[model samples]
Target: MSHAGLFISFEGIDGSGKSTQARLLADHLRGLGHDVVLTREPGGSPGAEEIRALVLQGDPDRWSARTEILLFTAARRDHLERTIQPALEAGKIVICDRFADSTRMYQGLSRGDLRAMVDDLHRLMIGMEPDLTVLIDMDPTKGLSRALARQTVEERFEDFGEELQQAMRTGFLALADEFAERFVTIDGGRGIDEVAADVQQVVSTRLPS
Candidate 1:
């Protein structure tokens, strides 16, 4: 799992603006002449993208908690193998919209008390962690509202309603504590430019010169 490049992942509840910030960071880095690979979970590589449609577009109860953990892990493994690892090995900066941490929150804690199972599978299958994780902390209510407004087919998670979003916010904050070394919390309620500036500053400190 060791590589010559930096691996960064973004984690937050639905509507936390993590995806937009991820893209903004990629654009900033690339403009600075850094080689960057911008990707997302559940559908980064072709194989993982296929699995994404299965897990993200169905009913809220489409897959049980255990089943979801398996599917997300499968997609993550493919993403790592096909997209993430290659870029990292080539010494490129790999910025992922979401990663195993998303699975930990969405599948591990949201549905049931299966976090241990999620961690076990991750250690066994995806034995790596991001060098830095930017957590775009936002109010669950506001985040959920922003998320629903998108009106995309990937609304299965959002369909679970605000209660789930509240729990996810709490869970993600707790996770930031659990893995504080790599997690940096940022207030995401600000304007896009403000948030992107903070993201760039945090990441610039860690990027290789």
Candidate 2:
């Protein structure tokens, strides 16, 4: 947890409803008058957005795991420098949709050699990370169904089939097990109000009180 201001992040497999839940939580906090900066990874910065497109383009079958990992890292570097750092420095509560943890799950867990990449990033660029990370845990199949129902394949990762996405979800859980200090998994298979309430409670209890 952060010593002073709140710096929280949300993580999940694609279609885990992180963005929706993040918005709900941020809205709840703002209702209480806290300054909140709600944003997403692979974006939230000009440079990162470009990298995001590159990372998410084409068919999932055509993309390599190493390539996915590197693209994620590149986008993260831009986001940290351009969006996250500035907001945290201003003492604002930042609720990022995803952070380095996504890379850990997607690249390291799914692909290979996650430790080396994660350590390098921690050592090189990222200094202060999220005070708390909310992992929206759900069946990847269910999530993929929901996501696909809404969109028409905008990117590569988004195009991954349900089985592969389920594997990705397991990877995310492995990250939570290893880094329990910062990761809090929430059941996102519940009703929207229930999920939002859980997120709100987690933030209120964890944030400065």
Candidate 3:
């Protein structure tokens, strides 16, 4: 919708190096003559940070499915209003580690309606979508191994067993396929630098001159 700035999102299962790659890409973008802002979902703005803690504290039983989605959507609304929108309006490229796609993958696992809810929330809150979304792909077994290896703190999802984690991986890949045009699934099994290079290539090729 006539944005001079670009919105790029990185998505994947935990430990797929989305955060690291997001940072790397942001840095690379800034180096290549772009004003860049790096942020994450459920924790970008102050209000969202509080929601993030409650969401990750493993209190699923305390939250109904609708409640969980609503909390995430509320956090997203605040983040877009307070952080992302201003950055974009200022003509800064916004590279987000996770966005509405995470809600679809995490909350919509069993409840299909949750995906619709998240889509509606995204449209209402952000009023836009990423120009390109990169989904870092890795086997869940390997991803969890990496996740556990890097874990200083465990979130609710990190505690899930192989089965559920694998399902989540499947969900991400399915989404990549579903939104093929906006989605690019990178091979996250490679070394970090190698993956970073691949991501840089994608960014350099797409970024506006």
How do all the candidates rank in terms of lDDT, highest first? 1, 3, 2
lDDT of each: 0.95, 0.80, 0.83
**TM-score leaderboard ranking:** 1, 3, 2
lDDT of 2 by residue, 32-101 (tens): 9988898888788999888777776666666576767667777877888787877777778989998887
Q: How much does candidate 1 score in TM-score?
A: 0.99
| Residue runs of model 2 more than 4 Å from their true location after superposition | 1-4, 61-63, 113-115
On the 0 to 100 scale, the lDDT of residue 34 in model 3 is 85
Q: Lowest-scoring 10 consecutive residues by lDDT in candidate 3?
A: 152-161
Root-mean-square deviation per candidate? 0.6, 2.1, 1.8
Tens digits of lDDT, candidate 3, 43-133 = 8999999998888776436566677788888898888888888887888899998988888888866434577877776677657778899
For 29-107, candidate 1 gives per-residue lDDT tens digits of: 9999999999999889999999999999988999999999999999999999999999999999999999988889988
Among all windows of 10 consecutive residues in model 2, the one with the lowest summed lDDT is 151-160
- In model 1, the runs with Cα more than 4 Å from the true position are none
RMSD of 1: 0.6
Candidate 1's displacement at residue 101, Å, is 0.7
